[model samples]
Target: MTPYDAAHSQGSNVLTDGFGRTVTYLRVSVTDRCDLRCVYCMSEHMTFLPKAEVLTLEELDRIASAFVGLGVKKLRITGGEPLVRKNVMGFIEGLSRHLRSGALQELTLTTNGTQLEQFARPLAEAGVRRINVSLDTLKPELFRRLTRGGEIARVLAGIDAAQAAGLKVKINAVALKDDNAAELPELIRWAHGRGLAVTLIETMPMGEIDADRTDQYLSLSALRAELESFWTLRELPLTTGGPARYVEVAETGGQLGFITPLSHNFCEACNRVRLTCTGTLHTCLGREDAADLRAVLRGGGSASDLVDAIRMAVDTKPKGHDFHIERTLPPAVARHMSTTGG
Candidate 1:
């Protein structure tokens, strides 16, 4: 029997937090390194975790398996850029077993789309049907300015490659007031024209970046009202299991989603947790409390011991996160979104 099956046989496979939220989604950060440093995500001069500090691929798989054993149905591999990690495809292929065995419902990743041109076909072959690509703007200069030095052409080509590979692509754009606010209408129309779903996220106050987050933060509620002027947005009663709420666009017959953590709190139904590259389990993205799964793993703990650690961590999951954006205050959480597997 598989580890998950063995755990299930023991009858201790459910993971429920203190608020009675049954945790079902796990986002794992394979690495803290990235090819491009976005202004909103990282500091101008960022310091990454040491190689020895990050968990190995095998360790990641083992922990993820334990989570699956504990009723985690969806797993999303994230990173500063997950594909940039060496031999990550093999790691993803290894996890495909749970998908085949019906223990896991979905296996996907959120990428910057720079590496999609090369990894798209392999990803589809590994059973990843849908992926979230981060694209804020289509303008070459603005894209370059946002991602520091990333080429917009490469990202577009990567998106094209992903579509050709039969992978359903969803665009995730961070709503920035001074940056992409005016361009959002064009961006949404472009994505809908291509038969792709787009999710607009408010700029979160997560880490200490060169730019002030207060200046960048845009409320999705306000944005939605503005979109209603040009396009007919009908609220859809659908959820993909994350915090985003969906709406259908009448003109394009496509879907548009909003992830508003700042303007509107989404923690009431929070059923997700983040696992950092260093094996830290963050019960909530907006909170600093975490459990050290790496310590449990490296200390020669047994399978049951690891499971117990996860359960103990879930037991302490906060009812909701404390996320606020004010110029006078620091980040809600000192860690960057990249570190916590955005």
Candidate 2:
């Protein structure tokens, strides 16, 4: 039987997976469409999910509530670009109500920061705690080239707006070996100068990237060695629930994070799962194992049915992701990151 605390028997729901890790974070992708088509994230011939197939705001809320009941505390709203969805601010407002009602501990979002100029203040007022913005390059030309026509100035404006709204901002940059490896120092200086933290991620072997995966993949250890050559890196605490290891950079007074999915895997402490825009529950990012919640939800299933589905998924959770083992191999994940809520 799946591990479960007797309902309200202990005054809280504790849902533990097969690995004995308690899940607290849930990532929900609101839309599969994005404004910027970064070369690493999507292919040129990608076809997004139809509007009719995407989950409605009401349906999303119901799903979130059920997860909360199953012991999910922190909720992150993601997307190809979450802010690109229509009336998404209203949906955030509704989720904020849930936070106020004590159904959720924290509400956060991950965006491209292009729409933050208009949505930042509203998001703050709606009870969002923080946001992670995808910014692969600092140079205007490089940013445009990387995102297939994104303006770095506009993203900077959006970041400024988010800061003004009192929203904690973090810059998530994917380190491409030949592309942005040398620019790491500059990116760190730029982010820390503005009181924002920057996280460097290794390029995952998912989707059709612009460059060769093996050639483009840069290990965090290698990046750290380069950073240490210039500045001293002091280890810091891991307060956040994510996989990124934290470090404080000397001289610059900035914090740097490395998400070494390929170098030093953090799957032994994995405590999160993903919900796709179409209501598919992905138990693991590196594996294609998923539970189709859309079928249950659309088939006139009750909240109890949804709970059962979640319980079964947790029971059968894989040992861990095989990203490290499949480094040089073909992509094991059939679905693109956009569809998987990355």
Candidate 3:
């Protein structure tokens, strides 16, 4: 039997998927355009969506308000790089108003750390409580190779600014075999020194970029084994709303997290859906099951109509997804990680 609850229909605005997962977290991609050309995300000289096709801040505010009304407690602003979008601070401040009004419980952001130094204080003032920055390699030369001209110093400066601004910061590292795999211990130590947690994620096969993904498929098991060889890991209580498995590093008295989307499946506990900048509701990351929320928004739909559309999208959520590297590419694998708000 599928793990669906048919009794709760579209009439009510509760966002529960087929697997009995109560969806409360909404990741909103503000823009698909990014400044950096990471090896695993997109190719150099990429084409971005036209400005007219992107949703205005007002439209995003309305859509976000509707989701909050349906019991969404948390909202994460994501992007190719959220800071790269124009007037992003204003957008964040608007979301902050929702938090202030008690309509939202948490407002956070996931950024590439390229532009955090300039926006950290303003962002925190805007009521963003937590921030997640993507940092794969600590070494400058390696960072340049991976991100294609990204400066390590700038990211480090951004992290410093985030910390100084009194915002809770975390580092997200994508584990790549024979690439940054060996640097895990050092990376952990560096992040721990700054009182920040590090979440090492096994790279998922999102899009076909200019990289040998087959060689880059490093398992979380390998990463954990490498860490265990030096430091002791103690299982910690799960408090974060995301899928990462947390462990306390006994050596540094710091926290370490593993998001093993590829090796270990966490779909059974999935409780989130993605809203692209184009206003499409993607029920699953590894599946192409999407509903055009933009169409509903632009078709003279009422607030109730928008809620009904979201309900219908949640109803079509898959029980689980089959995301693994295949000799032949999977249809869903065509999704660019950048565009998907990964």
Candidate 4:
């Protein structure tokens, strides 16, 4: 039976298909407009996607519903900053109702954390309980300098508001060598006190920062050794077959995660697929291949048909990302994290 036809019974839920692979998670980018001009993501003079081409709420709702119907249990709404989009909470409310029907189990959102304060309470009420906030530094001057126009205080305040609103908050810190690697110890301590999880990710080799082999660009393997002094970190378990190598701070109630895409590719365990803000289905984040979902949607295909297409795309997911950065390997189509869904 086709992956779609097998969806009715959990006993028959298959990760593998005709292509022999399983599918599960989906990441949706809500918008391409970001408040912070993070040096890595863009230039001070970067131009964003035209508002006309961006997907409307109705379009997003339709595509998201189709994914859930295909047995996608986890959904993460990403963006230039998902909250910057108009009526985003309404979209979340609509998604929550879908989850209530068993097509979904978790609905999460990722943001830069600058606009969280005003949004936290209302967003929590709208049924968003999990939040991943990107925070590169704790130092004001450095934070502003790195994030360009971001206010560290505002981001921190947003974190507080979200925590107060009872959202499960996690801070994402993308580190480079001389930049904020030194602040990892302090950041981890702060997160533990507030019961928040912290994930330190390596900067993908792209954008202006891609060049300049400065001391700022450190690897994930190195981050572990750097933190050994402060806390006795022990490996924890995964959630829903997650691929991150997690470690808990034994003394504190906090945890740390490492997404070492470059050093250690998790291609074998990659069950996720990406959809750009415009509606292209990306089978691999580091692969040039993508199936055009917009064409199918605009062609007046039914939602069930869309789900079947997703299953086919998922089954054919590449064995692993090419780390296509090295000159020896062919490059994936040049869509960076900022342009694609972060």
Best by TM-score: 1
Give the per-residue Cα lDDT of candidate 3 at 296. 87
Candidate 1 lDDT over residue span 1-342, tens digit each:
233332442346789998899999999999989988999999978999989999999889889988998889999999999999999998899888889989899999999999999999999999999999999999999999999999999999999999999999999999999999999999999999998999999988899999898998899999999999989999999988899999999998999999999889999999999999999999999999999999998999878888899999999999888899999999999999989999
Cα lDDT, model 2, residue 195: 92
Candidate 4 weakest ten by summed lDDT: 1-10
lDDT of 4 by residue, 1-342 (tens): 112222333223444544565667878888878888887666677678887667777777777766665667788898878888888887777877756676677888889888889989887887788889998778899999887867899998999999999999988888777888778888888888888898888766544433343334578887888677766889887654355778888888688888887767777767777787888878777777787777777788765666666667776777877663454433344666766788
The superposed Cα distance between candidate 2 and the true structure at residue 236, in angstroms, equals 1.1
Which residue pairs collide, candidate 2? none
TM-score for predicted model 4 compared with the true structure: 0.89
Better of 1 and 4 by TM-score: 1
Q: State the local distance difference test value for candidate 3.
A: 0.84
Model 2 lDDT vs. the true structure?
Answer: 0.83
TM-score, per-candidate, Cα-based:
0.97, 0.94, 0.94, 0.89
Q: What is the descending lDDT order? A: 1, 3, 2, 4
lDDT (Cα, tens digit) per residue for candidate 2, span 213-319: 78777888988998888799999986577888999988778888999878988788888889998999987788888898888889998667878888888778887
Clashing pairs in 1: none
lDDT of 3 by residue, 1-342 (tens): 111122222355467877688999999999998878888788776778888888887777777777887878899999999899888887788777668778678999999998999999998899887899999989999999888899989889999999999999999999888888889888999899889999998878787677657778888987798788888999999767888999999999899999987788888888888998989888888887789888987898877788888888987898777688755664346778788886
What's the lDDT for residue 37 in model 3? 86
Candidate No. with top lDDT: 1
TM-score of 3: 0.94
Candidate 4 residue pairs in clash (backbone atoms < 3 Å): 15-22, 176-216, 177-215, 177-216, 177-217, 178-216
